[model samples]
Target: MTTQPHFFIEDSLLYAEEFFAGLGKITRFSGRTVTADDIKDADYLLTRSTTKVNEALLYKCTKLKFVGTATAGYNHIDADYLAERNIEWAPAAGCNADAVADYVISSGLNLANKYGFALKDKKIAIVGVGQIGKRLTKRFAALGCEVVQFDPVRAELESAFTSASFADVLACDFITCHVPYVKSGKHTTHHMFDKQTLLKLKPETILINACRGEVINNADLVEVLTAGHDLRVVLDVFENEPEIEMALLPLLEFGTPHIAGHSLEGKARGTEILYQILCQRLELPVEIKLQDLLPAMAVDHMVLTEKYQLSQRQFRALMNLVYDIRNDDVDFRLGLAKSPDSFDSLRRNYSIRRELTSLKIYCDDTLYPTFTNLGFNTSLIKGE
Candidate 1:
């Protein structure tokens, strides 16, 4: 037999090696270029961000029946071309929404507290209300804040939520962006928040970008900051990523290595969802065992109010002690700024982070209950 059906893995499939090892004739090609010739005899093609599937590639891979990308962004793949060729494609969507949202909410709330602002009374504006946006809205709303969202695609579905024009969202105290990349279109967010948009915000507003970097013009942002505009900026993504504008470094209130959604649970879930889709599309038995990351030890988190003497005022300090936003910023500046050659290496090998489950908050005399009420898991650090 001709080695049953061949499955080719291009780009790094974080946990795909183990998932495909049990199947027949699986070849792991990490970061290899996925050309037409490479997929000529292959029954399935697996890839991550690096590979792009289009007409040229499809015409070459006449035998390829399935394309599986273990990423949320499908813009790299030509979906229409694949459909015309009767080829199936699958991508993991919304798997990392909570993880991304957790990062945004935690960072936003933490930043607000740091700046002597009350989150409950603030108005938050969110653009591109997709999966990540919806999660962000919920978390912010949970904290007793009003969330105004803008997304033409979701205006009807999100009608229950406060809707607003883009300009209206810009007028809020805090603005968070979550639109995807669009090369060319009426809704192209290529430079949605350019110099003009940046100038529209109030001087005291907090500007956040967790979506694509190009969504905001880097030069315009730097110019605004240079001109004495003191908007607090938090960035988890940047244009020309891994090569952030050096001038913008000093302007950021919080910066990270784009690991906002790098939470252990979310990464594993993304892998699991991708694997299942691959199996179903290829008509094979899913043999991949999706292992959840090791859960963190629990501590008594109830007595937070009593043991730590924490009130709402101290919430920022508590979160900072546990998750330092500045540390991530420092690491990004140091790691990426050291040399340009190490950019790809640093990003691909970025550190693995724990979820909220990994944290351990301790307390005495029922302090655990109080911490849990405050939305923290504290059983690990506490001695039961």
Candidate 2:
């Protein structure tokens, strides 16, 4: 029997080494620190966005057969090179859709509170109508806001989908980006929100980017913010990993170390996606279930009365219990203050954050539809 193919997993994917124990000679390495030499003899590569699986890193890895990224975005992976080498690749796309949407919703609400604006009265634009963006469209529209989806690709591809023009999108009260980072394409998103675009926004526009960093030019953003442009920006991802543009920190309304999809379920779900794909390729039965792999939620059970119904304001308190963007912002700034490379360190030890689906809420049956539409896990109460 040929020695089981070597498996190199990122150490941050907690318990992944053990998860693949039976199938391979597993080695766990920090994603940022792993080099080509480390995977030279590896037959499989399992990694996160932090690890770039490009020719520069994988040229020495002769035995590599399959590469999987436990992330929704695949820009980090050089797909063109992978395809040329006949190496199969897979991304856990949309595995963290709910988690990322939660972050956006939370961030939006936080900004509304600080800016003294009502979300319902605002015209919001979702820049990409993909997984996370689609969920946001539903949630924001359900909350009575006008949502304009700006996805040129989807508009061209989907017969039923409609996209907003760049001019129309510029006039929205808020704009959030969820598109992938494409360097050279008609629909390229890298530095999509550069100085020219950033300056054109209507006054006091709330711009958000949880999708990717270079999607908005960091240096341009710092310069724009420095010039005191009437705009508020929130970022969960940065242009550079581990080391970000330090001057941009104080200018951000909210900044985090790319933890938008760091929810416990989200990360596990991504890994699970890769695991199942690998199992299929190897003709092995996947015995692991996602639910069994998760730990108990922090607030496992919540009771909702008529007073706790889902109003724009009431929902904030509820969401804050699960996540408060302000807290993450503070932590991000503090971490960077401690060390420039504190980004990966912060992500490696990210606190356990459970998705709304992880928490079960007991509520009257009448409100079941409302809660479910907002993506909560709920138990219906019978009328007595």
Choose the strongest candidate by TM-score: 2
Residue 89 displacement (Å), model 1: 0.5
Cα shift from native, residue 366, model 1 (Å): 14
Q: Cα lDDT of model 2 overall? A: 0.85
lDDT of 1: 0.72
How does each model score on TM-score?
A: 0.82, 0.88
TM-score quality measure for candidate 1: 0.82
Candidate 1: lDDT of 199? 91
User: 308 in model 2: Cα distance from truth in Å?
Assistant: 6.5
Q: Model 2 misses residue 338 by how many Å?
A: 3.8
Error of 2 at 63 (Å): 4.7
User: Which digits, one per residue and each the tens of the lDDT, describe model 2 over residues 8-83?
Assistant: 8887675575468877888888788888888888798989888988998999988789999888877689999999
- TM-score: model 2 vs. ground truth: 0.88
Q: For every model in order, what is the number of clashing pairs?
A: 19, 0
